[model samples]
Target: MERKKKTGFARYINLVNLGVFVVVTSVSLPIYWLVISSLKQPVAIGASPPQYIPSPFSFANYQQAFSQYGFSQYFINSMIVTVAATILVLGLGSLAGYGLARLPMRGKTTIMLTLLVISLFPGIAVIPPLYLMMRTIGWLNSYQALIVPYTAFNLPFAIWILRNYFLGLPKEMEETGRIDGASPLRIYWSIILPQALPGLFTAGVFTFTACWTEFLMALTLNNSNSFRTIPVGIALFGTPFNIPYGTIFAASVVAVVPIGILVFVFRKSVVSGLTSGAVKG
Candidate 1:
């Protein structure tokens, strides 16, 4: 009986391992292909019997993306919009989250529910109205056009994450600060914000990623080359007659680098923030 039980447990463990292997491979294969494709020379990219491994790895595509295709401008535009939006989201979200989590206010539940609903509204559903508004205000084809919308759209999720994180913190800390005659803002800035680093990092990462990869709004709002983002710029890479797959792949790899680095650096904090407040109000 003991031997049979051991065999069954081993079989289960093997199955779980196989499942993990399959999932990892499925996710990684495409990324591997993209990286390899980016490294291959332009002619070699679509060669017969696609090169699984780039024979003569060359960075000509990357150079062409930056110098020839003006991807540098797109990269800069994306960085500006993403960074500005992320900063605004974090600054505004922390305050709103702290208030919702700690303050004694009427209709708090209703407000939170409303925020969740608003966040769920699809970008496509709201784009027409947003485009009209931007056009009316003469903000079309500008950085603020994208930055403002990104901040507004990402703020709710940041607030929810932060509010939940704040709730999980000890109330006694706030009470102690109050006893010391510390103002709410002072206490929050000094005591609360420091401990909420994990939540902040998580929110920042998510907001940054969203703003970086956002397509529909970016495309609709900023159509001009001067204001085009990575996604928009990548889409317009080559003319209909001749497509530049190598350059597109290189640009994509470049765009993915920042996000990959950010996530990797803050991975632990992100994991902790996401899980810590999950069950705490």
Candidate 2:
């Protein structure tokens, strides 16, 4: 009777899991169908029910996006800006966060609150002055225009995340480093920073994604093709009258895959980083 009860419970659990799988698959099927439809030829794509798989699996859409839109240049530009910005945010933000967490100073709370408030403001709110400043510095239509602003705008949020994570860590670790004759910067670089890897990864990933997908600033700031990033280039798929759904969809998939992989591969670290000291403070 005991064995039979255990087997029955196992079967019930399996059935519940199968039901969940089916529901999830059902929800995702439409999205899969939409993406597959982009790879299909226009004639077949416009058909009544639409096809899941493309007939010939044509590379035409990707080819067109590359050739006509100069998407390759845009992709490279976006990659450069995103990577550089992510690095800056990680390095500077980590240090700033550490300082905010450990160092005592006058009006630190006021300064931190000010930063949080500024970060909460919408991009459009500051675009006019920011644009004029960029133009005055002659950074308009240059890589610096995009990368500098991307890093600066993202820094506040990154700092806050790192600060929170740092606050969670115990002070004993830093004391141990200092007892071993480590200076402030040395202690930060070797001890506290290393321990905050998870938070760093999480912040870096978020910053990278934000910079990668940012469109409004990229569109307005870069008028020339040479400085255009992926989001701006993707916008070209839609003219006044017509939109190239296939090319847009394919490029979007291309854009998303890397980010998806990045987060997926580092998910454990990101989660661990975010939740590391949640229970304490």
Candidate 3:
């Protein structure tokens, strides 16, 4: 009887795993098709039956996007803004999170709730004010226009994640550092921060992705062709009358490739942070 029950449990687990695999594959099909379609000739892309395989695969679409559409400059602009914003978000968020988690404070819950509310505001809602502010500061059409907003928008979630991770850590760690005559900042910088690697990586990845794909503010704040990012560059990938689907799809793939690599590289850290943050504190 016991062996049979165990066998039944194993079967249930297998069923659940199979269900998950099916769901994942179902969701991934469109993305997979988009990628494959980007490599096809324009004629093959518009074929009657839809060619799943590229008849004559070529990098023509990518070449057109990079050379004709000015994706190279846009890509560089994107990298600058995304990297700067991610760094700012991680630094500020981790510091703020550490303070909230470890330091004695009043109305901490209220403060945290306020931050959550701020983050909940839609990006569109703040565009007018942010645009005006940037114009006043002479920052319009500059990298700061994108970087600053990205950092501000991403900081709340970064802080929430880092604060939770910090709380989950044992107070004894800080106390032990204090016993060694270490300053609070020293403890955080030298000891606490190192142990928070997984959480940092998780927050960094989130901030980077958000900064990378952001479009509305990037569009609203900058009007110059020289300052456009990948999303904006891809959006303008055609004449007034014609939209090139294959070229746009290729650009889309290029836009997403960095994010995919980032996730793959730091996947273990992300999983660790998520698991630890979920259970601890």
Best by lDDT: 1
Deviation (Å) of 206 in candidate 2: 0.6
Which candidate, 1 or 3, has the higher lDDT?
Answer: 1
Tell me the spans in candidate 1 whose CA falls farther than 4 Å from its real position.
none
- TM-score on alpha carbons, each prediction: 0.97, 0.87, 0.95
Which candidate number has the best TM-score? 1
**How big is the positional error of residue 202 in model 1, measured in Å on the Cα after superposition?**
0.9
1 versus 3: better TM-score goes to: 1
lDDT of 1 by residue, 1-281 (tens): 99999999999999999999999999999999999999999889889999999999999999999999999999999999999999999999999999999989999999999999988989899999999999999999999999999999999999999999999999999999999999999999999999999999999999999999999999999989999999999999999999999999999999999999999999999999989963356
Pairs that clash in candidate 1: none
Model 3: per-residue lDDT, tens digit, 122-195? 99999999999999999999999998889999999899999999988888989999999999999999999999
Model 3 scores worst on lDDT over the 10 consecutive residues at: 272-281
Estimate, for each residue in 50-129, the C-alpha lDDT of model 2 and write its tens digit: 56678878777778778887778989999999999999999999999889889887888887898889799899877888
| lDDT of each candidate versus the true structure | 0.95, 0.86, 0.91
